[model samples]
Target chain A: MPNLYDLAYDLEKGLRESAEFQGLKQAYDAVMADEAAKQMFDNFRQTQIVLQQKQMQGEEITEEEIEQARKTVELVQQHPQISKLMEQEQHLNTVINDVSRIITKPLEELYSENS
Target chain B: MPNLYDLAYDLEKGLRESAEFQGLKQAYDAVMADEAAKQMFDNFRQTQIVLQQKQMQGEEITEEEIEQARKTVELVQQHPQISKLMEQEQHLNTVINDVSRIITKPLEELYSENS
Candidate 1:
């Protein structure tokens, strides 16, 4: 008999085995193999995260930070590998989001006070 | 220079640190500390999973299986420890569902074809 944690472990395994996850891994590896693209992606992602954190914290994002982010995005977009990785990421996000929707269904009933 | 996989790893870490996950852990620990409760929980959860899987697979569930599941649910509900664990679980689930809603926001745009 599997415990709840065991069921969670299985879900993790299922996620790893899913096509979208595997595709994301493969695309990520492709980008990593290119030193220039990897460096560019790193810079772009760092700026993105910083800006996101700022927004989340309800802090005003300075124009300089926004411009810096825009430039970084431009650089990342110019890189073919990085662009491909982003596409793969978007595809993977769709799968992940769908999975989240399904996994949280039981909670919805409770949250909605319908059960 | 964090790659996409690093971001994914960070998300996993965040989930582990979230209140919902922590609450679930505490509830699970409490249940596990009671040998009898743990054993009963294991049996009850297994039966519930079986019935759920059968329903998902669109298979015909026998009256005996339904009766068995009802009995298991009744027993689990009558157990004080199980009831407490369920309450904790519901609380944790609310947090989890909210987290899912937030995490999937970016995907929602793509899914909705609004961007």
Candidate 2:
């Protein structure tokens, strides 16, 4: 009875107001408010982005770089606020993933038998 | 008032029944019905996947490989059914991208004012 885009926006509004999103936002805000945790998270993200860029460019990433990235991840995961933020991010991702799976169903069904 | 996942399923059904998706399905089926066009399309897809895998693995793709892939693409583009399928795929992608943009709004807004 209603437009698809209208329903999409309605779903968007619902997701933004949902509990998972609220917890993610709260955790993110807490991380941002703490100077040390924020800096640690920033460094971790920088490490991740650099590695991702190398991967995207098809450049060989050395073991040393991988080790450094792992250490950076460990450091950030050790922080209470950052750890909470990461946990909350996973929760939000579950909801987002569910929506994506539903959206991609048609494409999957189309290729199911042949592909 | 309804569940977010409920609204998502509603949007999914709407998208599946939309003109863009219907057109895409029709174009795809037409390609599958023609043996010559289907074989050409399959060859093009296999070429694309091989190159994509090379890129993912950080391997050097030779210029000859690139040229071969370019020729495969040209051959597919020349086919009526495959070309129509690509055009319809683009139309469906527009609809899918719109939904994705709506769904990602919260994450965007969260990081908007910060960084």
Candidate 3:
């Protein structure tokens, strides 16, 4: 029998082979292949990271920053490749969410049984 | 500028550095270090995978199998190392859940803005 880590790696490989994941990878690659789209996505991601760090530190987000984020999001969403990437991400997230629940079912059953 | 995949890799690295993850790793190592515990855990995992596959195939599990699984979970839960591993897994899961939400916040914000 394979070890738990080995099983996890197998699961990862299975996910990579899944259509949803493949779609996501293709969409991501498309965005990266376009220099302008890549730049926009990177800027959006940097802004996202900064906001995340601030929120984690309990710092308030400013109105101006929020406006900037909104604009960046709008611009990115309007880009064909970036928009496709986000759509593919959502599709892959759905599959991942189902897999997560399925994987944890055994634990849920065990705990519920004993409790 | 770093790409989205690079940022994701950084997030993975950060998760590994977290105390919850560290605790989980130590607990996992403890269970794997004991030959008997490792054997028992592997058996439980194999049973789990079988049940998972059966369910995925739309087959109902036999009552006897359910009972067997219940007993195995109980036995493993009683094992010191296995129990510690489960406890640590819950802690790491909590951290992972939070990270999932945080990482998706950018998309969430963007969607909410347009909607």
**Top-scoring candidate (lDDT):** 2
TM-score of chain A of each: 0.83, 0.92, 0.85
User: Model 1 reaches what TM-score against the true structure?
Assistant: 0.50
Tens digit of per-residue lDDT, candidate 2, span B62-84: 99999999999898888888999
Name the DockQ score for candidate 1.
Answer: 0.03
Candidate scoring better on DockQ of 1 and 2: 2
What is the C-alpha DockQ of each candidate?
Answer: 0.03, 0.58, 0.03
lDDT of 3 at B8: 42
**Cα lDDT tens digits for candidate 3, A1-115:** 2233333444454555556666777777777777888888889988999998887655789999999999999998998889999889887677556655544443354334322
TM-score of 2: 0.90
lDDT of 1 by residue, A1-115 (tens): 2233433444455555556656667767777777777778877877998898787655788999888899988888788888878988888767666556555544453334311
Model 3 DockQ reads 0.03
> Model 1 misses residue B21 by how many Å?
14
C-alpha-based local distance difference test score of model 1 = 0.67
Ranking by TM-score: 2, 1, 3
